[model samples]
Target: MRRLFPVTDQTSADRAATAPPSPGPDGDREWTFDELAEAYAYPPLAAGAVWLRGNMVATLDGAAQHGGRSQAISSAADMRIFGVLRALADVVVVGAETVRREGYRPARARAAFAQRRAAAGQAPAPAIAVLTASLDLDFSAPLFTSPLVPTLVLTGAAAPSERVRAASKAGAEVVIAGEGPGADPARAVSALAERGHRRLLTEGGPRLLGQFVAGGVLDELCLTVAPLLTAGHAQRIADGPELPVPARFEPVSLLTEGGFLFCRYARADAPWISRDQG
Candidate 1:
């Protein structure tokens, strides 16, 4: 992968004009996992602060998925970045439907990130937080019974008691995030933050991501643009209630590999930005 924005040459030149001519853009050189990790690290946060980020991939025509799964539109490089993002997060917040459709499982402890996670006071593996209203999930699934860290079930206070009991019996923690039948997006973030999971990453199924966007809790977006195109009726990266005024975001970084463009964008009001851009 090669960086496509905030070129290193310009920034290095400005830092020390007398220094040996910096190797121009990292053209043609594949990026190491270490480099990718650094490029996508979460921004520093104050005490009790949360930084919610969404990671999704789409086709050139804006199809978030094909044939009911996102893996169809994703590439190897995108998967690499996906692993890295999971490695860096304290918890992965996802919609229940996404967990079901994608055959979601527990987040594993990656050897590459073990040291960094330990240094940050994080658990061995990031927990999977599934948002559901009815709590109609397979309690027998391994996601609940066998995660390195117990999986979390985010639901409403009015959720069915039996299902909540079932989730608890299966070893998943059920968090009440709303008063009604649905989990309120903002409440969900606060709930996770209260658990010391301040670095949040959501692998959206579009609907849940739309809710986060609508709730105005999403701080950043890491979008991978695939070169392929499928004209079918596929969801956009975020699909939900329309905003009164469209939210604006600034590009933080851009990387490309094998015809896929990986882009990171921070909320316009967020302090995060590319070093050179800052």
Candidate 2:
């Protein structure tokens, strides 16, 4: 793995304790799981709001997926970081479409993170929160029925009663955020915060990400740029209609391994303006 930049001299113990040695010039700068977890740790929290963060991966040409799923473009290192991020979050928010497409299962407790989670006062595993408007999800699926923490379905009051009933019966904790059929993303965040889930993480499927952006609730984005290019109709990272104005983000950090670039961008101080209000 090749890092874009050089690392400063560090203690022999700290350097050696990190992941395996890299074969490249940055041999002394190899990253271990412990080091990566520390680097990507969630920031200090605000008093009463959820710190929303999005994690995504894309190809060199900016294709978010190949053959209709993101797994084709993901690397082992990316997945390692993915697991660390999940272990750190209180809840993993996802869209219903992504859950279906990726065949997502309930997040289980990782032995590696078991101590850290317990020390942090977190549950054995992060709860999986599925965002849906119609509540058209499979209640029998492992995501709903077999999670360490009861799964949450963020929907609207206007969602189909039968579907809501089925989800509840299957051990899901359904949350109604808005009056309309579709949930208001801002309200969804608030609802999660009310339940004491302040460390929020969203693994999106584009459209749901767009809603977060539209709601001006997105605080940070962790994007992995894969070295390969898929020159097809593959979607971009965040897909939504044209915004009234552009949102700006500033780079926080850039790490690279095996030609893959891990980028973190934090939203600028620009005020968030929800589309519904605009």
All models: lDDT?
0.87, 0.81
- As a whole number from 0 to 100, the lDDT of residue 23 in candidate 1 is 28
Candidate 2 per-residue lDDT, tens place, 36-100, comes to 66666666554665678899999999899999999999998899879888988999999999998
The TM-score of predicted model 1 comes to: 0.93
Model 1 agreement with the true structure over 207-267: per-residue lDDT tens digits: 9999999999999999999999899999999999999999999877788899999998888
Residue pairs in candidate 2 whose N, alpha carbon or C atoms collide under 3 angstroms = 1-258, 19-32
RMSD, candidate 1, Å: 4.2
Q: How high is the lDDT of residue 88 in model 1?
A: 88
Q: Candidate 1: give the clashing pairs.
A: none
Q: RMSD per prediction, one decimal?
A: 4.2, 6.6
